[model samples]
Target: MNNIDTRNPELEGLAKCPTGIRGLDEITDGGLPAGRPTLVVGGPGCGKTMLAVEFLVRGATVYDEPGVFVAFEETAGDLAKNVASLGFDLNGLIAQKKMVIDHVHIDPAEIEETGEYDLEGLFIRLGHAIDSIGAKRVALDTIEVLFSGFMDHAVLRAELRRLFSWLKEKEVTAIITGEAGETTFSRYGLEEYVADCVIALDNRVVNQIATRRLRIVKYRGSAHGMDEYPFLIDADGFSVIPVTTLGLDHEVSSERVSSGIKDLDAMLGGGYYRGSSILVSGIAGTGKTSMAASFVNAACARNERCLYFAFEESEGQMIRNMRSIGIDLGPWIESGLLQIHASRPTVHGLEMHLAMMHKLVSEFQPDVVVVDPISNLISVGNGLQVRSMLTRLIDFLKSNQITALFNDLTQGGGAMQSTEVRVSSLMDTWLLLGYVEENCERNRVLSLLKSRGMAHSNQMRELILSDDGIHLTEVYAGTGGVLTGLNRLTGEAKTNAAEMRQTQDLDAGARAVRRRREALKATIAALRAEYESELDELDASIARERAQQIALEDDCSMDER
Candidate 1:
């Protein structure tokens, strides 16, 4: 979007001059209107000066477009000293003839009301400065100061129009800064109507935390983002976060990424999808951070870059704590495969934290990102704000094809599946962790609440954290409901004992039946033998009685034969 040749053809009619600042060009669809005057209005200390100066500096340094800074509020030396912290060397640019800074000092005490006041002398000075460096960009710091004591509305409006027309005729893109008015965008209310584009800057404090935002109030002849984007001004200069730029149209990957625990991956049907947003929600002491660290460790083990955002604990503290679970993040940090950014959630507003996350992810180019305990963000913003911020963050990470794992803390005494920030709907996969109390013992349990595009297990498993690592064991479920902790062990033991006793009883019954069958067979054998002996004895007695008859029978048998 920043590239001139690659910008959409529809936006080609309105030529845009790239601001060269990170994320600014994206929201503008290209950048500010080219060869036109843009009014930047803001309250005091709202970064109007910094924004104007950085615009000029970026033009001169990055785009190779020489720019002139006509300052009405500060001298050239003061301007240089003020912006030096942002790494902009005004003296170097001036020495190289790439920039020109001219201070137009206006003293109200010396000013006298003259008939038909016009900025004729100011034009000559500005024109000379523009021509001296062949500047293509010009910035007027606080143009309202030029006519400080003027009370004629007609004169102020006419001169403002004339000045804007002159800049247009010169064909140099100009930025005119103005103080925010009580009821209007600018003090004179007419600057916004006259300029080609108007940008508003706001510095608001919520819960004692300051957050800066930028909004494009109007952009004539161009379609631009109207949302108030969070911007950061630090040592790296201005960076606007285009949170809404990414939508749900990002391409998805079928590839899988491990959840770091072997059985947990099995429950998730091979693991979470690549480029997916996973939410690990649990009550306190349910190993949310440990889960996040495990994912980070797994990612780092693949030689992939990982970024861990720790809001509750410092980097060293997290590293040391994770070591207890056999997850030593120190080596990954030392190898440059992992970066741990630790800061209290209250240190900045939710949007600022979102902006910093965007910035770090862009710079680090990590394959996986882990935000430990995203619930801490609730301290800075309401539930809706946190949800919005997380939605944007998830979209941003998905758009970049970075797998993100967020640790969310679920409040106790609430629905086990519900998270305090209510961002569960934004996650592609949600793993709910909590304590399952049974038989006078509390045991950590994990269950797959939901996983998009995969068959996930709904059964709860006992989550065990040992010295070696995390382990997931199947909990015992029976007529007594789901059993965990010592109850599960006891149930298993009882089942085993019952099975063993049943086996022993069956063995004894089979032995007794075999013994009875053996005895019966022996008795039958004895009875048959006794009958044979009786028959033999009867035959012998018959033989004795029939001995005489046998002789007679033998004679008869011989006669019959």
Candidate 2:
């Protein structure tokens, strides 16, 4: 046998086939190895058959490459009905000659183990199905019945190995499913070692909740995410959510969107970036929803589409609740500028929720997406899972240049930290909301916890909700803390009173100085008048003296004559 070069295809330029599964194609680097058999082993109800059926179905539907599915355990009709709920008309595809489904029923009791029995019959059936449609893809779902039907294990293993190699020789990409063994991944321990790629599916219950996951156990020539990823089986089909994207290569936007509250937007450095993720975390009854409503209104006012993922309340209830605060989301909803999707967080697993968001985002193509009370997702998933989902969400939104706003409902009365601690670090901006008590009354407080790229105010503003909408009041900090509510009014009163008194004193002192200046001016004017009169008299006396001297000179001249 020639030594084969088995390296990651991503680096070796080996071709790959796209699975067309939502995130599965991305996770597997590009999908399974092209024209090679991939072994899918998992426990019952783990979606082995579904995965195989989807592989062939997508190959024919999306790739335009015809496929054949050979069922060893299920009949063609049963297989068709099973995936019909997923909207896959396997029978219709068969009628169109785009796909072929062959059922190979093998009975162990009817077969005699005296002769040399290879998988010639199985090969003939698979070949006929493939040749019927000129298929480039084939699926042998759950190959464990072959072992139960065949008595010789050695002959079965040899035939299985030959079967995989022969499919590769025919250049048809095939999928082989098997029951999971306790120690080995497959029952016969023969498929995994022979196939070019191996994938494991799992459906486990944790904390009374079921989570379906998929993982790539082995790949002959491709680099893939080996971590167990969350997958969802919804009406659309199987969708895998990769934990997160590779790097921060997503595009950033310089455009800013208003936060709805004018003063609050001013504090956020002219609002959030277009493609950034925002976390509005706060304790209950602290205007978190009001803030989110303001953002939605602003987005709709811009004529940009916005999606509101409401987890706490229904659409009508949320509209009514927001109306109480003077935010008329009803008009926007009617106008179709805003879409509010209200679903209970407990309705599905976290992965399913993520998948829903992804689907809506893709369909709506909204400029902004709002997930109200993201903290509620924690009840279904652990911290790591939530973080992973958030990371992926943020990456997707950023990549699409779509703004995502997440509202986190804190647990305790002022437990802002516990709500979005894991997601806070991933968010582009974190707005913390809390309550301040003064004069035996509660007041809503808003403060910026962090902002990644822009300069934001560090001061906490008093969040005032009224019929006019949310208003952010300038907060004054005294020795106690940020003065709010009645305290703020009292502080403003005292400050105004002090300023008035100081102005009054300054005015009184100015009057006194003006009086003194007028008196001094009068005295200087009188003194100048007196000095002028005295100088005039002295000049007259000098003139008279000169006259007398002239007269004496004239007398002397007459005597001389």
Best by TM-score: 2
Worst 10 residues of 1 by lDDT: 1-10
Task: Pick the lDDT winner.
Answer: 1
Question: Residue 71 of model 1: what lDDT?
Answer: 91
lDDT of 2 by residue, 414-478 (tens): 45575543678888898988888879989988889899899999898888999889998888786
Q: What overall lDDT, based on C-alpha atoms, would model 2 receive against the true structure?
A: 0.86
**Total clashing pairs for each candidate:** 0, 1
Q: Flag regions of model 1 displaced more than 4 Å.
A: 1-12, 113-116, 149-153, 192-195, 248-255, 300-306, 315-320, 323-339, 355-367, 395-401, 527-561
Cα lDDT, model 1, residue 260? 86
Q: What C-alpha lDDT values do all the predictions have?
A: 0.88, 0.86
- Candidate 2 runs further than 4 Å off: 1-14, 108-116, 245-247, 413-418, 477-481, 521-561
Deviation from native of the Cα of residue 103 in model 1, angstroms: 1.8
List RMSD in Å for every model shown: 4.8, 4.0
